[model samples]
Structure formats: C-alpha cells, structure tokens
Target chain A: MSSERSARSRHRAILVLTGLGLAAAAILATLDHFTHEPIALERERRALAALTAVLPADSFDNELVTDFIEIGIDGLAMPARIYRARLAGQPVAAVYDVTTDRGYSGSIRLLAAIDPDATLIAVRVLEHRETPGLGDRIEVERSNWIRQFSGRSLDDPPRQRWAPDRRDGDFDTLSNATITAGAVIEAVRRNLEHFEVLGESVWSDPEDTEHD
Target chain B: MKPEHQDIWRQGLWQANPGLVQLLGLCPLLAVSTSTINGLALGLATIAVLVCSNAAVSVLRGQLRPEIRIPAFVIIIATTVTVVDLTLQAWFHDLSRALGIFVPLIVTNCTILARAEAFASRQPLVPAIHDGLAQGTGFAAVLIVLGASRELFGHGTLLADADRLFGPAAADWTIQLLPESWEMLLAILPPGAFIALGLLVALRQWLIGQTGALRARAGQSEAAA
Candidate 1:
C-alpha cells in the first residue's frame, strides 16, 4: 500500500515538472516571435553605422549599406563584403568588411576603407572578443591607435613594413596588445593589396570580377 | 513598517548583501565592474531578471515538489533571462553589445536562484516581490560602487561612457579625476577586481564590528545607571 502511494506522488511530480516546462517554453516562444524582427533591424542599423564611421560623410553620396558586393578574399577567413562609396556617380572609396582569426582571443571583424588612389581612408574594429583593458585599444573609441592607418598605402609603409613596430614595421604597437595590433595591421594591408589588384575594376559589376 | 518586510530589507541590503555578504553572482560582479556604465548596465539587467523570476516562483510554489523544485526554478530563471536578453538586443543595441555574454549568463547568477529557494518560494507574493527588489538593489549598489572605484582608478574617470547606458544626451556626464594619460592598468584587470572586492568586504566587516561594539558599550552604561 505504501509503495503504491509513493509511486502516485512520484508520477504527480513528473507531471508538475512537465507542465511548468511547457509554460516557460510557451512564454519564451511568444517573446521571440515579437522580438525577432526588431533584433534583425537593430543589427542592420549598427552594421550600417560601422560602415559610415570608416568613411567620411562627404566622401560618399550613395547609401553605403545598400551599395555593396560580396567576394571571397585571401587572408580573410570568410567571404568579404566590399561596400562601394560614390560621390555623384563617381567612385570615392571602397570599404572592405573583413574578419581575421589572428586576434589573441578569437576572431576580430573590421572595416578597411581605401580611397580611389589606394590610400587608406580609415579603419575601424566592428567586433572582437579581445581582452577588454589590453587588446581593446584597437577600437577607435578606446584609443587613436587605429587612426594611425589613415592616409597609409602599400608603398608608404612598403610591403615588408606593414606590421607593428614591435616586429620592426612602420606601425606603432599598442602597449601590451601586440598580437591584436598586428592582426588588424595585417588584415588592413591584405585588403589594400586586394584593392590595388582589382584597381578600377573594384567599382565594376560583381559578375566581372573572378573573386569567386 | 511591518516587521517581516523590514527584516527582509535589512537582510537583503546590509546583513546579507549578495556581493559583500553572501558573495553570490561574483562572476558577473567582478568581470563587468571594470567601468561604471558596464557595471550599471549589467546590474540593471540582473535586477529585472531577479524580480521576474522571484515573482513567478512564488506564484507557482505550491505546485513545486521536492523532487522537481530545482528544475522548475531553473526553467523559470532561464526563461526570464532570455526575455531580458532579447529585449535588450532589440531596443538598447549599444548597451547590449557592451554587456555581451554577461547578460545571457544572468541565468547562472546564483543570487537569483538562491533567493528563489531561500526566501521567495516559501513567502507570500507581496513579500516575495519586496525581497526581490531589496536583494536586487543591494547587488546593484555594490556593482555601482565597485565600478565607480575601478573606473576612477583604472581609466581615471567616473561615468566615462555614460552615453552607452543613458543615450547620447549623457555624453558629457564623464567626470575626469586624473589625467587621461595617467592610468593604472592593474586597477582594471582581473587582479584589480579581486583586490577591490576584498577591500569592500573588509570595509563592511569593520563597520559591523564598530556598530556592535557601540551597542554593547551603550548597554553596559545603561545597566550601571
């Protein structure tokens, strides 16, 4: 008799637990249904903002977010999105959205904008998992370390000198963030080289380029 | 002014602060307290989750059996945290990015679960809600204090990035205490978090000791008279 009573209570426990779990799931699903659209919209807005930050407002007349081409590039672990900047139907600059896996912690995504003449307009870190106080100096908000890339081109720093000064290169390394600094510098240089190779063709239709 | 409500406030705030006394949720407390804005953002998120989870658990306490109570609490807390995480992502994009994984990790913050088991699950709805506010405020207070001290010492400013939490109108809320170039890197590192929290815990202990001694002395004088 005691065994049967205990078995009934145990069965009731499982039923109660299942009921609570289902209720929680229902609530979560409802919230996700409502928030899904706004979350995507917010992500797109931030991405567009990052692109805008890398290029001067006066430099680009076209919508930077909508004006873009996707291509697979070397050095970048993933396919890259190159956003074309135009001023009154003429190409002003091309911004390469690239990701590098060489950061001290993990992947670091960045934007490198190159002018028509192959000179760098600016570079900005979009996302990174780097150590906060040490490697986060790569952010334009944290320090002006990334701003040093402005006006730099392949020939100015030369091909071999495109690295942190710690490695005997032309660029200065952030204090205690040598690896992260090196990764950003390397990614920027690689993107510039790719841009130079593409030349005026970078502004051409996506089908013409053999980047695939 | 009810005795039970007052007792709850006393325990949550001073006598049993999650940060200084219970030492609950130390992971988020120590990790995100590097800046005032970061700490404040995470603290607010934590408070929201705690209040919601406590209330839910209290309302359903009768159905929870000993065999399944723990799992039930976990589901409720996890669901509340996800809702908060999504809400932040949708509305407060910048602050959400600043907080990163810490916001979702609020589910693992033992303070929420501890309160559910210790106070909320057994209490009435009103007192359960009261306990939630008290405990959450206590935890947030410690975070703000720790964050301010760390930001002042490490970055040489207080509320240095207020705009992240309070929008662009608060861009100028930063108060620079030291020169921008004069930063003590150690103060913002993990080791600094440990040291600052240790000092805070020691300060609380010293204050309690002093108050106890004063009360004892007053009692002895009264007996003599």
Candidate 2:
C-alpha cells in the first residue's frame, strides 16, 4: 500500500511539472504572437530606409522586395540577391547584396547600388567583422569614407584606380588597417564591374558566369 | 532605511555586486561599456529583464518542483528576455541595432539565473522585486562609471552619440575632452577593457583597506579620549 502511494505521488509530480511547463509555454506563445508583428514591421521599415539611403529617393515608385532576384555567379562564394527598383515599369536602380571574404578578419557584407548609366549610386557597408575604431570607418555611422563612392562611375576613375592607396590606387586606405580598406575597395570595384557586364540581365533573369 | 531594505542594498549594491564583487554578467559589462550611452541602454534593459524574471519566478516558486526548477527558471528568463528584446527592436530600433547580439545574450547572463534560483525561488514577491532592482542598479552603476572612463580616454568625449540612446534633443550632449584629431585607439579595443577592469578592481580594494584603517583609528581615538 505504501509503495503504491509513493508511485501515485511520483505520477502527480510529473503531471504538475508538465502542466506548469505547458502554461508557461502558452503564455510566452501569446506574448510572442502580439510582439512579432511590430518587430517584423520595424525590420521592414528599416530595410526600406536603408534602400532609400543608398539608392536615390523619389526615383523608384514600386516595391523593392517584390522585385527581388537571386543569382549565383561563379567566383563568388554565395549567391547574391539584387533588389531592382522600377520607375514607371522600367528598371532604375539595382542594389546588390554582396559579401566578400577578403576582409582582414571575416566577411564584409555591403550593398553596392548602381544606377541605369552604370554609375555607382552608393556603396554602403551593411555589415563587417573588421576591427572597430580602425577598419570600421567603412561604416557610414563611423565616418564619411563610404560617401566617396557615391556618383562614381566605372569609366570616371578608370578600372586600375580602384585599388587602395597602398597599392597606388586613388582611394585612401584606412590607417593601420590597409588590408581591410583594400579588400573593400577591391570588392566594390569587382561587384560594380560585374553589374556593368551583367547589365539589365541581373534584374530580368539569373545567370552564373565566372568573370575576373 | 529599514534593516530589510538595507540588507537588499548592501547585498546588491556593495557586498555582492554583479559586476565588481559577484563578477556575474561581465560579458555585456566590458563589451558595451565602451560608451556611457551604450552602458546606460544595456543596463536599463538588464534591469527590466531581471525585475520581470524575478517577480515571475517568485510567483511560480511554490509550484516548481526542485528537479525541474532550473529548466523552469531558464524558460522564464528566456521569455522575459525575448519580450524585452522584441520591445526594444520595435520601439528603439537604432539602439537595438547598436546593442546587436548583446541584447539577446542577456538570457545567458548567470546573474539572472542565479537570483531566480537562489533568492526568487525561495522568497516572496516583494523581496524578489527589491533584490532585482538593487542588483540591477549595482550593475548599472559600474557600467556607467566604466563607460565614462573609457569614453573620456578612448574618444576624448563624454556622452558622445547620446542621441543614439536618448533622442534628437540630446544631439549636442557630446562633450569634447580632447581635440577632434586625438583618439586613443587602444582604449577603444578589448585590451582597454581588461586594463580598465583591472584598475577598477584595484581601486575597490584600496578603498576597502583605507576605510578599514580609518575605522580602527577612530576606535583607538575614542578609547583614548
């Protein structure tokens, strides 16, 4: 009789524990349901804001996300996503999300936006693992070094001039972080050249080709 | 203050500080304390999570079986952190972005779990709340002091980018301690954090020793008089 009673108590303990866990899960799920929408909306708002900052404002009327295209190009580690902006049903600007592993530490992800004439609208570092207080100057929040890329076209500086100052390039490299600065300059130049070669095909269709 | 109140402050603020004494939750402390605004933002977030989690744990203490208490506490803390994290993302997007992974990393902070298990799980609702406030304040105080010292030396500025944490009105809150060209790169790096923390620990030890000696001298003087 005592053994049966002990078994019954153990069963009760398990039941209580399970019940409490379920209650906690239910409460959290409800809270998550309420908060998830706002968080998602905020993210969307920020993404649109970033798009406007890099691409010219008032140039594109249609939604950017709905016009997204994904293409895997040879010589690139990962497939790139391009957000094509259209004005009156014609493609105006393309923002390429490119990640280059040539940075001194980890990958440097950036949005290189190109205009219809193949001129660079802006090159903004979306994310980077470079050393802070040094290479981080690539970030628009940290410094205006990134602003120099705006309104620059492929033919203006010439292809060779895109190298870092250390490599006799026209662009100035970040102090004490030459490798990081060089990598960014190279990646931006390469991605811009890719956009030029691919032209409007980047938005119309996906293609994979090895271009150096 | 009443003895109970005093006990809470003494334990949370001085005797068992989460940053200096208890040495709990130092990852965010050393990382985000690079600037006063960052520290304050993270500190407030932590306090919010701590208070909410503590209160929840206390309310559910009776029903939580000992064998399953740890998991229950973690679930409660994670839920609280997620709520805080999502709230920040929704309302304070810029600060949320600046804080990045640290905001989510708060769930892993041992201090919150320790309090939930040790104090909140055994105590009533009121004391649990009080303990949370006290501990949070202690942690924030250290973060602010460290942040101030680091920012002053690192960037030669105080409350720089205050607007990032506050709002548009605080745009001019940045104070230039050094010329615009001067920047101590070391002070902004991880090594600076280690050095600053070491100095803070040394200062605390020195202060304790001096106070002890002063009290001894006072007793001798009283006896002689």
Candidate 3:
C-alpha cells in the first residue's frame, strides 16, 4: 500500500519479466544452433539429388567439373557456363552450359545432358519464373517441353544441331509455348556442343597421364 | 480473456486461415502441393514451431523491455524454428528436404509473428500455448486440405506419397480414383492452388454458415418456447 512497497512490486515485475525474456531467448538460440546444419545440409542434399538425377554423382568421384567454360548462345547474345560430365577418366556425358535468355518470359537456366553417344540424358531447369499455368509449362511438373530434348543431337557436331520442331523440324514444341520451346531447344543445342568441344578436358579424370 | 482465446482457435481455422484467408504462404503451398504428403509435412512442421515459440513468448511477455521486444521475439522465433527444423532433418530427412526453405522461412512467416506480437506478448504461458496449438492446428488443417485437394485431382488419387508424410503404414493409404491417364492439367498448377484455395475458403464459409444458422434457429425456438 505504501510508496516503498509499490516501488518494490514494480521492480519485482521487471525482474520476473527479464528472467522470462532471457529464458525464451536461450531456448530459441539452442534450437537454432542444433538445426542450422541439418537445414542447410537438407537443401544441399536435395540440390545434389537433382544434380545427380541429371548428372550421375556415383560415376565420378570428383563430383564436379572445375573447368567453367563459356559459350556464345545461339538465341541469346550471352555466353553461359559449359560443364563436362566425366566418369573415372573418360567422358561419359556432355553437360551443356545451357540458358534460355529469350523466352516469352524471363531468362531460363538449364543443364541439358547428352551422353558420349549424344543421347539426351536429362534436362534440368536451373531457374525460371514463367506464368505458373501457361508459360511455366517449361517446368518438369507441367508440360513435357523438357523431356522432348532427351534423344536430340547436333548433326553439325556441336556447332549447329537439329531444328526445333516449332521452326518446322523434328522436335515438338509445346502447343502454345513456341518461344519457350525454341529457347530450350537452343540452350540444349549449345549445351551439347560445349560437351563435344570440352569433353576431353571436362570429362577426363585429372589423374589420367595422356593429357600430359 | 476466455472468449478472446476461443476466438484465436476459431480465427485460425476459418476467419483467418494463414494460407487461404490471409494469403501468407502462397509460395510453398503452390510449389510443393504435388501430393497430400507434401502438404501434411509442411503443416506439421509449422505446428511444432508455432507451439514452441508462442509458449516461450507468452512465458516471457513481462520481462522483455519495450525497446527491444521485437528483436527478442525474432530471436526466440528463429531459435524455436531452428530446433524444429533440425529435429525434422535428423528424424525426417526426406520431409525436411521436401519442405525446404519454407521451414526456416517460418521464422519470417507473418502468421507466427503476428501471433507472437499480438497474443503471446500480452498473454500468460498457458493461454499462449493454447493459442499456439489452436492456431498451428488450424493452419495445418488448411494446408493439408488445400494440399489434399490438389494431390487428389492432380494425380488421380489422394495421399500419393502417404509413406513420406505419414510413415510407411500410410503407403497403402493412397486412393486411386481416376484412370492413370486422366490428368487435370489445371488442377496441379499454381493457378490450381489458387482455384483450390478459393473453393476451399468458400466451402469452409458454407459449412460455418450452416452451423451458425442451425444454432440461431435452435436459440430462437428455445426463446419462443
């Protein structure tokens, strides 16, 4: 009831509050510390899995091609990275440095895989933000625009390849997704060439003595 | 206080669903609802974080200085989220990957933040935990329903990857409804998520209205008698 007692109560309230705040913060931080790696590793695992699905992780102990080459794109004015798919000192597949810069929407990054014999192994769209229903038909979940590139090859040996079905050729373009189809086809075309030209360096195992 | 707390649960389910009513988490809800399992996985993770953080905040509501409460709340949220995220990875690695950034991103989700700031900051620990559980369950319900709607129509079945979301026993829970060839191209896309959510919200509203009308009719009859 007195001033001194009221002041003491206020201080008690403040102390209790502070203790609670500190306790909550401590619990959260502990949780954060423990979960951080698994969350990150989970992301890495999924990304790695996607990559493995496209490029065989089991085949190459290297798990990567350090040499990053750039190739002038057919449809776009930009040059994208060229990666080689290697398996124990031999070129197993050509991982193209593929990009769809001129789609009906924004730029789309893709890795189109073609084996040493030049059969399409897989097409992985690295990035794209097309309309979810219409233009996003580019995604594997939507239209089959990607799978169409599976068996495609370049008769020109990495310089110029098969014409996109939309431009009146063999590969079929998405019914209403002509521009997307063309851009993907072009990225695939260039990607295969990067594999051919850079195959030896990209796919060959570093331990091999023949290069020296 | 009692009525307000009750409203919190009611609000999470119908009046203020995180996915449909508030439109907070359209990204993952659209990106991953290829199956019901994906929906259930995300919903459960969210519930875990919500209950933990909300309870922590409620317990500490009095001590946090007014000047530093926001940062304190965030630190708490991030921590609880981190723990839940880690637990998922260690125990449910496949699901942890499937939900991806959305789990950690739950730290930033407005639904959790709004509750921490509005309900947990002012309430006692017991009520706060109750609010958190109610809200979390509500949000999860919406996500699961939205997810199930898409998965069922998209794949011509429900619970396609039941084992992934609900363990191996649920593997047989998938209901094969349509002939495998019939795919509703519209139902599986992002637009489908929106359409599904819109229909879901409408369905919830209809159910709520029916319940309310029945209650009102009973009350009037009792008064007249």
Candidate 4:
C-alpha cells in the first residue's frame, strides 16, 4: 500500500511539472507572436536599406518589393530571390539574393546587383559566418574589399581575373583568409554570370506567371 | 536586508563568482567578448533571464519533486531565455543581429541552472532575487572587462560601434587610440579570450592570498601583544 502510494505521488509530480512546462511555453509563444511583427518590420526596413545602398538614387522609382522574381539556379545553395528595379517602367537593374556554401564556416549570403548592360553594379555580404578579423573583411563596414566589385563586369577584368591574385587573378585575398576570399569572389562572379545568362528572364514581371 | 542575504551577495559577486570563480557559461563568455557592446548586450540579456528564472524556481520550490527537479529547472531556464531572446530581437534588432547564435544558446548556460538549483530552490523569494542579481552582475563585470581588453588590443579602439548598444546618437562615440594600420589579430580570436580570462583569475587569486596573509599577520601580532 505504501509503495503504491509513493508511485502515484511520483507520477503526479511528473504530470504537474509537465503541465507547468507547457504553460510556460504557451505563454512565451503568445509573447513571441506579439513581438514578431516589429521584428519583421525591422527586417524589411534593413532589406530596403541594403537594396538602396547597392543601387544608385536616380535609377529606380518603383517599389522593388513588388517587382521581384524567384528562381533556383545552379551553383547557389538555395533558390535565389531577385528584386528588380524599374526606371520609367523599364528594367534598370536586377538584385539577386544568392547564397554560397563555399564560406569557411557555413553559408555566406550575398546581394548582387547587375545593371541592364549585364555589368555588375555592386555586391554586398548580407550575412556570413566567417571569422571576424579574418574573413569578415568581406563586409563593407569591415573593409573596402567588397566595394571593388562595383564597377567591374564579367569581361572588364576578364573571366580569368575573377580569382584572387594569389590564385593568379586580379582580385586580392585577405591576409589570413584566402579560402573565404576565394569563395566570395567565386560566388560573386558566378552570380554575375548567372544574371548574364538569364538576361531579361531574371527580372520577369510579377503579374505575368505563377512561378510560385 | 539581512546579514545572511549580504553574505549571499558577496559569495555570488566575488567569492563564488559565476564567471571568474565558478567559471560557468564560458561558451558565450569567450565567443561574444570580442566587443564591449556585444558583451554588455549579452550580459544584460543573461541578467534578465537569470532574475526571472531564479524567481520562478523559488516560487515553485515547494512543489517540485527532487527526482524531476533538474528537468523542471531546465524548462524554466529555457523558457526564460527564449522570452529574453525574443524580446531582444523585437526591441534591439541590431544588437540581436550582432549577438547572433549566442542569445538562444543562453539556454545551455549552466550558470542559470546552477543558481536555480544551488540557491533559488532552497532560498526565500527575496534572497533568490538577491543571488540572481549578484551573480548576474559578476558575470556582466567579467564580460565587460574581457570585452574591453580584447577590443582595445584587437582593433585599438574603445567602445567601437557604441551605437549598437546605445542608439543613433552614439555613432561617433568610438575613440580610435591607434593608427588605422594597427591591429592585433590574436587578441580578437579564441586564444586571446582564454589568456585574458586566465590572467584575471590569477590576479584575483593573488589578491585574495595577499589579504589573507595580512589578516593572519595582524592576528599573530595581537596575540603576541
């Protein structure tokens, strides 16, 4: 009788603890839902700011959010979401949200903007897991290495010169982060090439088809 | 409030410090101490979670069965950390981004669990709160010192990117004490964190030894007299 009573009490204790855990989780979930909206707004604001930084001020007039296309391309880890900018109803540039798994640690997300002439406008490292003092030099905030890709197209530096100078190319790698620099250079060059291959198709009108 | 509570505070803050003495939660300590603002942001988040968890644990102490107490404490700590993580992401998006994986990883920080078990589970509500604050402050102090040391040595700047912790008004708060070309890569890496923390621990031990010897000598002189 005593043993049975103790077992029953233990079970009751476990059940009570589980109930409390669920209650706590539920409360947190409610709070998270309430807070998620503001976070989403901040993220959108940041994305818009990043887009504006890569493109010139006078280039686009329409909303880039509404004028976008999504497609999966080779070499990229996931489906690339390309935002299009239009000046007077004509396509001015295409911005591709491409991610590469070639980073030193994990994936490095990039936003590559290409002009109507298929030349590269600018490439920004949106997010990365590279070492801070070493590979993180890819960030414009960290170093100007990323800014060098602004004016250069696929042919200006020539296809062969896309690799880092240490690899017998024009671009230079960071002091202690050759692998990361090489990976970024390749990701950017591949993105530019991808844009050139697709041309106008990269910026298909949103109202045209159900690519979803 | 009470003499007992004061002892608890002293133990948490100094004698058995969560950071320097106990050496709990070193993952975030070493990883995020690259910048002062980063460390401060993480430290504040931790304090918020620790306080809430300790309070919750103390309240539920009577009801929790010993057999399942560990899991219960973990659940409480994890919930608190998640709430903190969400709050930071919502209100301070930039700091949230800067902290990266370290915020959610706070759930794994043993200091919260240890405090919940060793102090809160057996203490009254007021004392639990006191312990949480003291321990959190200790952890935060160590984080800030390590962060400042690393930043000053690594980038040769103090409070670089202070705006991340403060706001837009603090954008120019960065003071560059070294030339642009000056940078010590080792100081920003994992090795530097270990070395700095080791030195701090050694200094603390040496100070404690000196104070103990002084007291012993004073007691001997009085006895002789």
Decoy 1 TM-score against native: 0.91
- Candidate 4: which stretches are off by over 4 Å? A205-212, B1-3, B213-225
lDDT of 1 by residue, B150-220 (tens): 99998789997799889999999999889978678888888999999999999876776789765564345
Question: How would you encode candidate 3's per-residue C-alpha lDDT over B1-225 as one tens digit per residue?
Answer: 554777666656656666766666666666666567777787788888889889888777776656557877787887777777778876687666567677887776777887888778888887888778887877778778877887668667887756776677876887888886656767877788888878987776577568976556434533432
> What digit string (tens of lDDT, one per residue) describes model 3 on residues A75-186?
6546665455466656666566556667776888777767777667888776675543455677785566677666666763343435566576667767656777777777
Give lDDT tens digits, candidate 4, residues A83-173: 9898988888898888999999899998998888988899899999998778999999989999888888888799889988889888987
| lDDT of the candidates, in the order given | 0.89, 0.82, 0.69, 0.86
The local distance difference test score of model 2 is: 0.82
A best-first ranking of the candidates according to their lDDT comes to 1, 4, 2, 3
Top lDDT prediction, candidate number: 1
Best candidate (score: TM-score): 4
Runs of candidate 3 exceeding 4 Å displacement: A1-90, A96-151, A156-164, A174-181, A196-212, B2-35, B65-71, B82-93, B153-155, B163-173, B189-195, B211-225
**All candidates: TM-score:** 0.91, 0.89, 0.69, 0.92
Give one digit per residue, the lDDT tens place, for model 4 in B1-225. 343877777677777778887899999999999988888888998888899999999999988889889989988988888888888889988889999999999998889999999889998888898889888988988999999889988988888888888999999998888886778988999999999999998987777678976546434533432
Ranking by TM-score: 4, 1, 2, 3
* True-structure lDDT of candidate 3: 0.69
Q: In terms of TM-score, which candidate is stronger, 2 or 4?
A: 4
Docking quality (DockQ) of candidate 4:
0.71
DockQ for each of the predicted structures, in order? 0.71, 0.54, 0.26, 0.71
Better of 1 and 2 by DockQ: 1
Superposing every Cα of model 1 onto the true structure, what RMSD results? Answer: 4.4
lDDT of 2 at A70: 72
In candidate 1 the C-alpha lDDT for residue B42 amounts to 91
